[model samples]
Target: MPLGPPVPERAQRLLAQLERYGSREHGQLAVGRRLLAEHPDLPLDGFMISSSMCPEPGRPLHSLILRVGEHDTDGITAWARALATEPIIDGARHQLDTILDDIGIWASATISEADYDMDQAVFIPSGDDVSFTHRGLLVTEFGEDGDLLFSGHPPAREVLAATSAYYRDTCGQRLRAFDGRDLADSITRGWCRFVAYPTRTDWRIRSASQDTPGALPVTWMYAQEGDTQDLGDPVHCPACGRSSRGLDYDHVTGQRVHLCPSPVCRHQWPVDDAPDLEATEHRQDQRAALAAH
Candidate 1:
C-alpha cells in the first residue's frame, strides 16, 4: 500500500518500473536520485533544494532524504526573523530567536500559501547549506517507495516548536536527533535514525559541521575551496562556470564577475576570489609595471 499524499504522476510511473526488484523494491536507486532532483518549492527566487529517498517495503518504511543549499537557508531565516516581532504570531518571536542562535544549522520556516508578512528577521545563507536545524520539515514528506515520515499532522508549526528550543541553544552547532534520538548516537546506535521515518536499507547521513570544525560563533565558517589557476579565462563568468565577453569587471579588484547569457540563469559571479591568485597577479603586475616605468 503506497502511503502519503497521492504519488506524483512521474513518481508513479517510475515506481511501477521498480516493482519487480526481487519483485518488491525495484526503482529504489532511481527514486533516491529523483528525490534529490524533485524538491519542494520555497517562497523566494534564490533558493535550491535536493533530496534522496530510500524505501524498505519489507519493513514498511520509506525515507525521503533532503539537503538544503546555503542560500535557501538564509532566505528562510530572514523571513522568519522578520515575522518574530509582530503581534499574534504566537511564538514566532521565539522562533526567530532560535533561528538566530545557530543560523547555519537551525534556521528555517514554512508558510502554508499565506501572504502573511513576518516581523521576525532571519538572515538566510547564500553560499552554504540549509539553515535552521529542521527548517527541513516537509509540507508533505513521502518516500518514493511508499512510506510517510511526516505530513499535515502535528503540523510543521508544531514540530518547529518542539525543536526550536534545542536548536536555539546550540549556537552554530547542529543538533541531529532521528526518530527521537541524538544524531551521533543514531549514527553509532542501533537502527534509530532509520526508524525516524520507518526505514530499512541504505540510509546514511553526513553533517556540514563534520567537514569544517573549529568554527567561531553565530555560524562557524563559510565553505572555502582551492581554485584552479587553470580557470581557463579569468574574464569569464565564474558563476555559470562559463566564460564570455558578457562580464562585470570589478574596477577595484579588476576581477571578472561573469553574467550568464541564459535568461534562466541570470546568475552573477561570486565576489570572493582566490587570495593566492590575487597575490600571484599582484607580484607579476608589479614586475611588468616596474619594467614599463
Candidate 2:
C-alpha cells in the first residue's frame, strides 16, 4: 500500500500537539486549556481525540478521530472545514468531512420510545457488574432469544426523557426520572434492583425470568426527591429500623412506598406512613427550647 501524500505544515503542528498531550487521560483537558487561552468565547463541555495505526504499521494514521460536545459542534465543524483545506493527504481530507457528519448526527440524534416497536421492544438496564466507559446512560435492548437487538449510549437527557415517556404511556404511571450520574451511583451503592416488564404490560412489574430476556431498573425504586413524597417525619423501616431515604414502587400493591436501604432487610412501607424529617427536627427544637427555659 502507498504511504500516502506528504503531510502539510498545519497537519504537522496538530500531529506534534497530539504527540505531546493527546493521551486518553489528559488529551481533552490539554485541548480544553488551549481552547480557553485561544478561543475563550467558544463553548465546550468535553471532546475526544483518537488516531488509528497507519497501514505502514507502528505509525500514526494521517486521519484523527475527533468528537466534540453539541455546544461546540458548530465551531469545531467550521474549524475542521478550514483544516481540511490544507495540503494534506486524501484520507485526512476525507476524515474532516466525516467528523463533521458525525457531529451533525450526534446533535440531532435522540432515543425516543417511539423509535422502537412496543410489541417487541424491551429496555435493559446496566447491571451491577457492568462498568461504564463514559458518563452517559448506556441503553441496550435484547431479543427474546438473548440476541442483541440494539445498543447505544444516547445523551443522558434523551435517555431520561424517553424512559419517563415509556413508563408514563405504557405502564400507566409516570416515574420520576433520576439523573444518569445518580442512577450510576445507586447501582454502585447496591440500591438498584432489576425487574423485567413487558412493553405491553398493564402496570404489573415482574421479576426477570428465563422467558424474559430484557430488564430495566426502575429509577424511582433507587432514588427519590424529598418533594416528590410527603414524609411527615423521619420514618424508620420496621424491619431494619433504618431511616427511609428513598422511595420504591411496590409492584404487588401498585403504590409508591418508602424503601429501607439495608441490604439484608430490603423492606418497604407505604409512602403516606413515612415521617417528615423537617417536622421531626422542628419538634426536637421545641423540646430543646422548653428544656432551656
Candidate 3:
C-alpha cells in the first residue's frame, strides 16, 4: 500500500524525469540559470529543490520552489507554463514537457521592497561586541563571549551599494569594508575595528578608538532657534577636554550637546560652546589689522 494518497501516474513520470535530470552534475545550477535568463523581469531571490519518498513502496516526489518578489505571482506562473512547452534542450523538445508534467512547482513571494531598503541597515553595539542587521535580518554578529555567527549569505550587492551610498550621502559618514570571518574575529579581539557598512566585495580594514575612524557620528538632533553650529565638525567636551569627532549627540539641560566619546568620561557640552576655529581666526586677523593701523 502507498503511504498517504497514491501518486498519480503523471506525477510519477515527472518524478522519474527529475531524478534522472538531477543525477547529472551541475544539473540544478543549469536549471536555475536557465530560469533566470528566461525571466529577466522576475525578481528571483533564490530557489530550493526537495525530494521525498513516503509510504511502504512509493515513487519519489520532487518539488521545485522559486522564491520571488510578491507582485510577480501571475507572471511566475505564466513563465512556468511556458517553460513546460519550451524546448530547453536543442534536439529534445518532448524531454522538458515530459518532465514538467504534473511537476510540483511552486512560487513563493518572499522578497519584499523593504528587504532592499538602505535605511534598514543598522549596527547595534552591545558591550564589547556588536551585531549588524538589515531589515531585521541578522547579517553578522560578534559576541562578547568570542562567538561569531553569520547569516548564510551576505546582503545583495545592490543592497550593499545602496546602503553605502545612504551612509555616505544622507548620514554624512564614511564607510570601510570588511569581508569574511577572520576580520570579524579581529574586531572582537580589538586587533581592528570597522563601521557596520554592508559590503561583500572589499576586504580592507582599519583600527581606531571607539569614536575615532570608521565610526558613525550621531547626526540626528532637534535644533533650537538661533543654533547655527555645524555639528559635523568635531567638538571638545569642556569637562573631559576630549574631541567629539565620532561621538553621538545628547540632550542635556534642554539643549543639544556633544556626548564625550570616552566611556569613563561621560561628559556633555552645549553645541554652541564648541569652538569655531574659522570665526576665531577671523577675529584674530581683525585685531592684528587694528594694531597695524
> Could you say which candidate leads in lDDT?
3
For candidate 1, the lDDT comes to: 0.32
Q: Candidate 1: deviation at residue 164, Å?
A: 29
Model 3: clashing residue pairs?
none
Q: Give candidate 1 misplaced runs (Cα > 4 Å).
A: 1-54, 58-117, 120-283, 289-293
* Superposition error at 13 for model 3 (Å): 31
TM-score of each: 0.16, 0.20, 0.21
lDDT digits (tens) for residues 1-293 of candidate 3 = 12124444443433345445463242443454445445555545556665566612433255555555554544554555666543222111111222332334455332232343323323333333323444543332233332233222333443344344434454465333221112122221232333232321211123434455443322111111112223466578788788764322332123344567689987866557665455456556656798999
lDDT of 2 by residue, 1-293 (tens): 12134544444444455455545253443443343444444333333454444434433333333444433334554545443532112211112333232221111111223432333434344433222212344422222321111124344455445444433444444444231125323221112223222222211233343344554332221223212323344578988799865675554443456778789998988777655555456556656798999
Residue 123, model 1: lDDT of: 25
lDDT of 1 by residue, 185-225 (tens): 21111111111101112121212232233211121111111
Q: Which ranking of candidates, highest lDDT first?
A: 3, 2, 1
Among the numbered candidates, top TM-score falls to: 3
Which stretch of 10 consecutive residues in model 3 shows the poorest summed lDDT? 218-227
Q: Write the number of the candidate with greater lDDT, choosing between 1 and 3.
A: 3
Model 2 spans > 4 angstroms off: 1-40, 55-67, 71-73, 82-145, 148-293
Model 2 RMSD in angstroms: 17.9
